[model samples]
Target: MSGKPKLHYFNGRGRMEPIRWLLAAAGVEFEESYLEKKEDLTKLQKDGSLLFQQVPMVEIDGMKLVQTRAIANYIATKIDMYVEGMFDLNELLMMYVIQPADKKEEYFANMMDKAENRYFPAFEKVLKDHGKDFLVGNQLSRADVQLLEVILMAEEYNPSILAKFPLLQSFKARISNIPTIKKFLQPGSQRKPRTTEEDVARAMKIFRS
Candidate 1:
């Protein structure tokens, strides 16, 4: 809040993961100031600090940025961490990752009792149909990181859902094991929930059978 950016969140991995990773990848210093779910937004309202009157806010050098993608992209730009062609690739993958969840919310949430549409085959097609690694290809872009998280989420939450897209499987496997990504895999960096080894092990057990 003083000089570098400070993140506000509900302690669970929400919109802040990618933003935090981007900041870390860029080697920028940030504060991960977590908040409880019941924490009052009144303090933010009183101070007129929450720009969009929302949680998951990021305060950078005294400026408040609201919404996850906005903050994530802004920080990526600030640190020049976005890979070449990252903007375009992010747009494509963003649509791929979000569209199905919006279109089939009841099927994804109510029927399944889950918060994600990870089972949607169309979602996997986004990457598979494109037939490219690293979202845009080769270089480690923000889109790569974001898609990597989504792939892990889909596999963990829905199970066997991503296998339909063998291309996606290969692509994800290659990037997930990238030296840079592997190096960043230290406990010091932020992580997406489904990315845990335990979840992956569970999924692999099911897939093996």
Candidate 2:
């Protein structure tokens, strides 16, 4: 790797927050490069700097890694925070729910069924069986950090949404209490997710294309 890793993304959290959380949890120093306008993206795409014409790119080891999940996975692996051989049910469910609006109705219906009948129960079982504070093993992993963001966003919509999932609520509380993560929550440490319905609608329109 270079002297320090570099991340490129928009000023908004978008897909970069999870990568930020992973870096913070690992106690790694890094640099951020934020794009300000559509022209910035276009310019990057015109060159080969942006492979997919997207932000959330990470520059490390003289290479640029594209895609949010891929970059997060790479960082998690570098810091040894990734849980090997484990598929995160919550993450899978989230991917399904947050897909493009064209098929969102169908995907959301499937997500609800999986969440109620399979995903949540499996997560609860893992917690009860392992008696651990985190989702995977005893220690916090990228999965936990990623899940915390999701839970936080959900709570924005309904404050008591997690009440039905006591184990998940407890897990979220535990992770939020971590010193690094607690510091991350302080005002201005990070950008808040774009929450307005119009902002979300516009974002979805771009995403669907």
Candidate 3:
């Protein structure tokens, strides 16, 4: 909060959406350094800025941070949106959805299957057990926003993914109605989630240089 924080990420919502949502929810002012070209990220990697050679690196509080979860957690902590025992609960809950024996493609297929058959049911139960207002507590937490992103991503792949989970569907609608989230949802200046083969080739060239 001392100075303007700079968020460097691919021009996509993949891992950066949660971080962006937390920032917007907190009303924090920050700058985005979009690495639209993968080679730009490769340049950072060569220049020693991208320690892990990954997108969504955050520069804040005079320090550079790596990893999506770490970046999101840091922002949530700063904004007081992080509730103990609430964040990352979905990850833990979905741990068994993808088995260790499955290959990448099989793991992804199983993940989609389990999301519908197993995860949504569990989430619906949790929603009923708790309240429909929020996932963690009475107030909205970063975890809820993260869940929203996950649901949206799933829905994008399969429009009817949430048709069975009434409670979860309701929950998605509830969060989407938030003023800040509503504004964020507007198809305006946000970058689309994509990367071209040429971008990948450029990244490889930089890597081999």
Tens-digit lDDT track of model 2 for 1-209: 45678888765556676778788777676788766556666667788987887777888878889987778777775333223212343354435435677987787666455545555565567678878787666788787776677667555544665666889878888888898888887787764553454544555544443
TM-score preference between candidates 1 and 3, better one: 3
TM-score of 2: 0.73
Residue-level lDDT tens digits of model 1 in 88-141: 333333333333545655444442332224333433555666565644545666
The CA-based lDDT of model 1 is what?
0.55
Tell me how many residue pairs clash in candidate 2. Answer: 0
Spell out the clash pairs found in candidate 2: none
Error of 3 at 59 (Å): 1.3
Candidate 2 wrong stretches, greater than 4 Å: 78-118, 197-209
- Misplaced by over 4 Å in model 1 are 1-4, 25-29, 37-40, 77-132, 183-189, 192-209
Write the candidate numbers in order of decreasing TM-score. Answer: 2, 3, 1
TM-scores, all candidates, are 0.59, 0.73, 0.73
Pairs of residues at least 3 apart in sequence or in different chains that clash in candidate 3? none
